[model samples]
Target: MVKVTFHQDPVTLVGNEVKVGDNAPDFNVLTNDLGIKSLADYQGKIKLISVVPSIDTGVCSIQTNRFNEEAKELENVSVITVSMDLPFAQKRWREVNNVEDLELLSDHRDADFGEKYGVLIKELRLLARSIFVIDSNDKVTYVEYVHEVSEHPDYDKALEEAEKAE
Candidate 1:
């Protein structure tokens, strides 16, 4: 149970706490087209997973866009942004913000991503802000569970590890 603060208030996070060297947990999340996707779907590529409480929020939008911009230069890396927002909303946000490089996924249907990744906010039904880098073998190479849900993640370190990942 990794605890994080949302708006400076403590919130409970459900599920296993993922760590470096651990096998990345597979999760069922929804694509912008409402299609089911799992971690295995990104096999053979380094994965940079950006988890946000909601995509519509300022911090979340900025975080997603930053990764989207960085993804263009990350060869063989599948950059994904996960949120508890609806698939329709994720699509709309991507269209409005012109975020095309990074795939925006929805965990709203069952929160499988959130729960499996230990980012699910029990009180709010949202995901805590976090970043995970998984290598081509599906082994986690880096994990950042942002202490404050409103704050930004350490993008540089996460990206660096993703680049180093095989």
Candidate 2:
């Protein structure tokens, strides 16, 4: 488990992140359209898994935009933003915000994907803001634990590491 501080106190994640060299756990997630998707769905492509608490927050929005920006030049890479928001909300956010390239995935129905990935906050019922770069074979090549929930990650570094994952 990973210890995180949120709401001025500490919370624990269900499990630790898949290590840098470990294979990412396969999970079924709902897309903005409520369609089921899995890590396998992104096979043969570099995967940037932007795990967020919720897109309603400032930090989440920042991360989503950053990934979407970085996605422009990264060929064969899919930037997937995951949160606990409902698929309908995700779609609305995408439409309103013009988030065209980035895909918003929701974990509202079943949170097993979050737990399986070791990012689900037990008490808060949210995901810790994290970034995982996975290779075509679903191996975790890079990982980041954004300890400060309100802060954005080092996008330049994460994107640079993503190239290596390819």
Candidate 3:
């Protein structure tokens, strides 16, 4: 378990924290259409899994948008944002923000992704800010668990790792 802080207050994170060279955990999350999606669904492609507490917040919105833009330039990579927000809210946010390139996934159904990735914030029922880059073979190449939930992740580093992963 990783010690995560939201606004300076420590929060407990559930599940094992993924590390570089570990096989990316496979978990189910809800797509905008209420369809079940799993890491295996995106097999054979590099994945950029962006975790945020809520997509509606300022930092989360900025993080998603930043990755949305970068997703367009990255070849053979899928950018996915996971949050505890409901599918309805995620859909609305995507439409309101005009997000097109990345997939907005909801962990509201079961928190499977949140728990499996070790980003689940026990007190808030939200995911702590983090970024994971998985290579085509499903091995994690980069993992960034942001110490502060309210802060943004290292976008450049994650993107670089995704691009470098073979």
Candidate 4:
């Protein structure tokens, strides 16, 4: 388990911590249309998984928007943002923010992604900020567990890894 902090206070993260060279865990997340999306659905494509507590917050919004912008330039890569926010809220946020490139998925159904990826904050029932890059074969090539939940991740490094994986 990784020690994560929200607002600079230590918090416990639930589930196994994924590392580079490990096979990416399969989990269920909800698409904007309330359909179930699994890791298997993204097979054969490099994946950039951006985990955030919620898309409604300032930092989370910036993180998602940044990746959404970068997703436009990347080829053979699927950028997905996972959060504990409800599908309804995610849909509205996408519409309001006009985010078109990145896919926004919800972990509200079972926290399946949150637990499998080890980003779930036990106390808050939200995900801690993190980034993961998975190659086309579904092997994790890069993993960054952000120390502070409110802060942004290493965008350059994560994006670079994703590009290299492609």
**Full-model lDDT for every candidate:** 0.95, 0.84, 0.94, 0.95
Where does model 2 exceed 4 Å of error? none
Q: In model 4, what is the error at residue 96, expressed in angstroms? A: 0.9
lDDT of 3 at 48: 94
Candidate 4 clash pair list: none
Candidates ranked by lDDT: 4, 1, 3, 2
lDDT of 4 by residue, 61-140 (tens): 99999999999999999999999999999999999999999999999989999889888999999999999999999999
Question: TM-score for all predictions?
Answer: 0.98, 0.95, 0.98, 0.98
Error of 2 at 52 (Å): 0.9
Worst 10 residues of 4 by lDDT: 1-10
Candidate 1 lDDT by residue in tens digits, 5-36: 99899999999999999999999999999999
User: Candidate 2: what lDDT?
Assistant: 0.84
Give the TM-score comparing model 2 with the true structure, all chains together.
Answer: 0.95
> On residues 1-166, what C-alpha lDDT tens digit does candidate 3 reach at each position?
5677999999999889999999999999999899999999999999999999999999999999999999999999999999999999999999999999999999998999999999998998999999999999999999999999998899999999999987
Residue-level lDDT for 53 in candidate 4: 93
- RMSD per prediction, one decimal? 0.7, 1.2, 0.7, 0.7
